[model samples]
Target: MTKNVMVLVDEQHRLDSVTAAVEACGVRVQRVMRGMRTIVGAVSDDAAIERVQQMDGVASVREEKSFAVPPNHRDIPQ
Candidate 1:
């Protein structure tokens, strides 16, 4: 199953290297927070998640939890 995850990188790691590693795992990078050293994306499966976690500069990987809200309740109308 596919899952959204937040990838945290080591401070010493270069963002380009980390991004390349994530892409190599076949995961799609949604957003890159350079200052925060965090990458958010969706992995193809559990194996992909493991692969990303084991990459050279990866510090940790955590699943991203999302919640559904009615359109009317949203901060910005759709």
Candidate 2:
């Protein structure tokens, strides 16, 4: 199953290289935070996650857990 994940890389590594590595694993990058050396995206499957984890510049790969909020709770008071 595909899952959203956060990919953390070494701060000193080049962002482009890191992105390339993740993309090569068949993962889609949703957002990139260069300062934090982090990339958020989805991996096609468990094997893709493993591949991403083994990448040279990757520090860690963590799945993103989402929590649902009620629609009423999301409204702000005027």
User: Could you tell me how far off, in angstroms, the CA of residue 75 lies in candidate 1 after the best superposition?
Assistant: 24
lDDT tens string, model 1, 1-78? 788889988988898888888988977899999999989999868888888878899999878987885667557765
Provide TM-scores for the models. 0.78, 0.78
Count steric clashes of candidate 1: 0
Once fitted onto the true fold, the runs of candidate 1 whose alpha carbons sit more than 4 angstroms away are 66-78
Worst 10 residues of 1 by lDDT: 69-78
lDDT tens digits, residue span 1-78, model 2: 779999998876788998988988988999998888889999878888889888888989989888865556446543
lDDT of 1 at 53: 77
* Model 2 deviation from native, Cα RMSD in Å: 3.9
| Ten-residue region with minimum lDDT total, candidate 2 | 69-78
Residue-pair clashes per candidate: 0, 0
For model 1, what is the alpha-carbon lDDT of residue 43? 83
User: Per-residue lDDT for 33 in model 1?
Assistant: 95
